[model samples]
Structure formats: C-alpha cells, structure tokens
Target: MNTIDEFNIDVRALNVLLAVLDTGSVSAAAVRLGVSQSAVSHTLDRLRQSLGDPLFVKSGRGITPTRYTLQAGPHVRQLVGELRSLSVGPPFSPDEAELTFTVAANDYQRDLLLPPLMASLRETAPGIRLQVMPSGIPNPEMLRKDVCDLVISPHPPAVGDVMQRRLLDDHMTVFYDADQREAPESLADYLQSRHIGILFATGERMALEASLSTQGLSRDVAVTVSNFSGLPAFLKSTDLLATAPYRMKDHLLKGFQRAPLPFELKPFTLLMLWHQRNHEDPAHRWLRQQLIDVAQGLES
Candidate 1:
C-alpha cells in the first residue's frame, strides 16, 4: 500500500480531488474550496497523472467519476474525515468556546425554536454565536458540503452521509385573529373559510391539501406567503385563517388566537440534521443535544 507521502499527493490535493468527486464539477468544487475553477481543474489533472487514470470524464451536464476514481473516492473521503476528527479537541466548553453555528429552519420552527434556543445560549453558551437562516426542507447534500451547520425541520433530509435525530413531534393547528371571526367549530367550517397558506420554496404544499382532501373538502387559499410570522398580520382584518404546527401557534400568534385543526392532521416529527464531518466534534454534539432538549420540552 502506497502512502500519501510515497505517492507525493499532499492532503490539500487529496482534499481537492474529494471535493470534485463529491460536487461532480470543477467549478462547484472550486467554490467549495474557495479557489478558482482552473485551480481545481489543475489539481484534478495532477491527481490523474499521478494515478495514471482519467479520474473523471465530462458527462452531459457534469463530471462523472471513473471506475478507478469511484473506488478511491470513499477512501479519500474517509481520510479527510479521520484527519478532521483527529484535529478536533475535546468537547467545547460553551462558556469559553468562541464559535458561530449556522442553522437553517422554516419560519414555524424558527418561531418556536429560536426564543428558547437564544435564551439558553445567552445563559449557558454566551461565547458561542448563532445565525438562524430560513431553510426549506432540509437538504443533506448541502449539509454535507458545509452550506449549513445544522438543519431543524419536520422531516430529516434524504441525503447520504448525514445523521438525523428526532427532536419532537409537532401537530398542526389553526390560527386566526382574535376578533376576525368565531373559532371554527368543525372541519367543515375550517375547510370552507378563506385561508392563508405558508409555503416554503422547497416544502411540499400537498401535506395540508391531502389532509383536507380526505374530508372531501378543500381550503380557499386567499394568499400564499413565505413566512408564518407574517400570517398574523395578514389575518388582522380579513377572515383568513392560517394553519401551522401546534408548537408554532403560540409563538407566532402571541396576541392572536388558535384552535385545533377541524380535521385530524398527522403530527410531523421534527428532526435535527448534521453532516458526518461534525459528528465527533464536542461543541457540535453539545449544541445538537441542547436543541433536542429544548424541542422536547416544548408544549405541543
């Protein structure tokens, strides 16, 4: 077995090769490495010359790994993983660790999760900073590429090389302004009323539709917005009602009112997703566990 030193392939070059294999394009890999596309292409050329095989060939839209490259890909990825793990120190002490973690979540989860999360961070992990970004359905591929440090969503993403843990289950609930109209007494009334649909760009709009279809009823979606925080303001003057997770109801509509869904909508299990790259990092593990605890303690 030839070691990296014997092959004259440094860790940086191996990393560039792994990035190309994972991203399937020199440009994308370059972006990930914060280098120009030409640099990635040159690295690939060097790797091919050293290995005596065309590692990747241009496909219809992107590059495809050759048989030899495919065989080596996993090994290279594993090497990078081992190196990262070895470099990481003991679990980070929240009070002393200066770190910033990026989390992607939908507006509903953001409403329910952020307040308590921030409060906990302020009290216990003040040195650690957080940036909450709006994420649609979680994308494991993006997570693996380090686009997001964590994803908090109803369903775990279906990307390979990622880990998921169920945080809590949140059921759907209906919300409307306090004085807009009387609370819907039944599913029939709920379906017939004008409704506001909150649509995340990547989420399935059919979940609510399917639930309504079961009762042979449907909603008149007067407006479709991108966030739950705006639904309360939208319902201020109209008879429009909004539906969201039960946990989000109180936080999103603090001054508004809510009622149970007229029809039985299955609860969605919220899961926290992270890349395998950070699986062994103590700080990462601590943050993940803290989120699970906060989510589990929510009243829903």
Candidate 2:
C-alpha cells in the first residue's frame, strides 16, 4: 500500500483540479490551460493521492466530479484567489519592485492613453513592464480570470466584483480629410456624406450610431472597420467621415480635422477597471493612481 505523505500540494495543482471540475473533462481543461491532457491527468493523479479521494470519475463520454470535489470546489477556488493576492506585498516600492502587468484596450484607448502612461511609468517604475491586449468591448471577467491586470474602455462592466473609476469623458466629433472634402456644415450634408463605421468584433453598433438611431437619423456608411487604426487609410483620400471621441484629437487626428457633430450626442466616459481581489493590493493601487494621474494631466 502507498502512503499519501510523499508529495507537496501547490496552487497549480489546485487550479488544474478546479479547471477539470469546471470543464467536466480532462482534455477540455487541458485546452483551456494550454497544457497537455497527460499533464492534467498527472496533476489529477497526484491530487487524488494527496487528498485520499478520487475527485472525478469517468462517466460514459465525459467525467463528473465526485462527492469530494463537489464539496471542495468552492473552497479551492477561494484558495486560488487568496494565493494570487499574495503576490502584491504590503511594502511596495516602485523604484525597487519588479512586476509585469497586462492591460486590455482598443486602438483608440491604446493610442491615446498608453504613450503618456508608459513615459510616466518608465521614469518612476523602471522595473515594471506593461503588456496590452486588444479589447473588443468591456468584459470584466478578464480580471477575474487573471488574464489582465487592468482594462480601459468606455463601456465598463455594470455589475460584478470589480472596481471602476471614471477616467474622463469626451464628446463625439467628426473627423474628415480637408484636402478631399469640405467639412459638413449642416445635418443633411453630414448624413448624406459617406461615413466609416467602427464596429467591434461582436457586431455591436457603437453608442454614437445608437444615439443617431434614436433621433431617426442615419449616416451613409460606405465602409465598416474594426478599430480606429483602420480609419486613416479610408478617410485620407476618400470623402469619408469618422465620428469618434474628441480626446483622440491630438494623437489620432494629426493631418485630419474635426468638426462639431451636426446632431446632439451624449459624451462617452472612459473608465479604468480592476478586480476587487486587487482592490487592497498596494502595488495595484499605485498603478491605478498613476493611470488616473495621467488621465487628469491630459484633461488639464
């Protein structure tokens, strides 16, 4: 007979077990974790020996969590959360601390906000590295899933175990090429001219379009692009217009010119979001404050 006191249990094993439980299959869990099924099976084997119970059982085409797993699942998830929180120590010195953070933002936010923020971080927190992922729309679960440390967007998650701060708000303005087409001086001219629509990956219309629809007004959208980065290619030589936030005026509209929207539209607010798990972490709090400071400086 083999004893259960041979191996040490770690958080990675716990996470592997929870992934298996949540996915209901070792292969599926492996796919989610970017690991091999054999590795997941090995982790499960070790966990079974240590816990003195088979946490899962094969059932026909798939597997099901056993009674032990049913009871321990919630506690294991909580344990993983607590373990993650331990990374941010109480004494945080930006000059001496080394850390890596991931952020998600679309092209507009990425271009408008990150350059200045990076300059500040390089000057103050030289040891920190920032990775930015493209954000299609606001999804707070990225923080809960530990995929990113922060998310910047106009549409923040409305309800969740997350904290959000209003960074700044900007009104909508139409950007057009002055050399190709004159600025629209009236509502009819704005609506009749060809426009470039910025649609997200999910096929969701922008808030600007929604505002126009509410007023029974619509633009003649000739082309649709996924982000603001694609607009310059189409707008520079053609008679196309792009309605975007005014904050992008300095960075996104260098050769282009902006004009007031012919119709009234509500200003959109950009928000910074982080998980509640990081709410009290000193390092995370410091980074969040730095972002807020950067945004305030731009606003002023």
Q: Which candidate leads the pack in lDDT?
A: 2
Q: Please name the candidate that would achieve the greatest TM-score relative to the true structure.
A: 1
Which regions of candidate 2 fall more than 4 Å away from where they truly are?
1-90
| lDDT of candidate 2 at residue 191, scale 0 to 100 | 95
The global C-alpha lDDT for each of the candidates, from Candidate 1 onward, is: 0.79, 0.85
lDDT of 2: 0.85
Q: TM-score for model 2?
A: 0.71
Model 1 per-residue lDDT tens digits across residues 1-300: 344454767778988987787777789788877899988888887777777789999889887999998898888878877878887977578888788999988777777777788899999989888898877766665686777899888776554457799887877778788776988988678878899986756656738887667767767899998677767778887788888766664566776678887666677887888987788788998999889878877844
The residue-by-residue lDDT of candidate 2 on 93-142, one tens digit each, is 99987999898998888998888889999999999989999877766558
Q: List the residue pairs that clash in candidate 1.
A: none
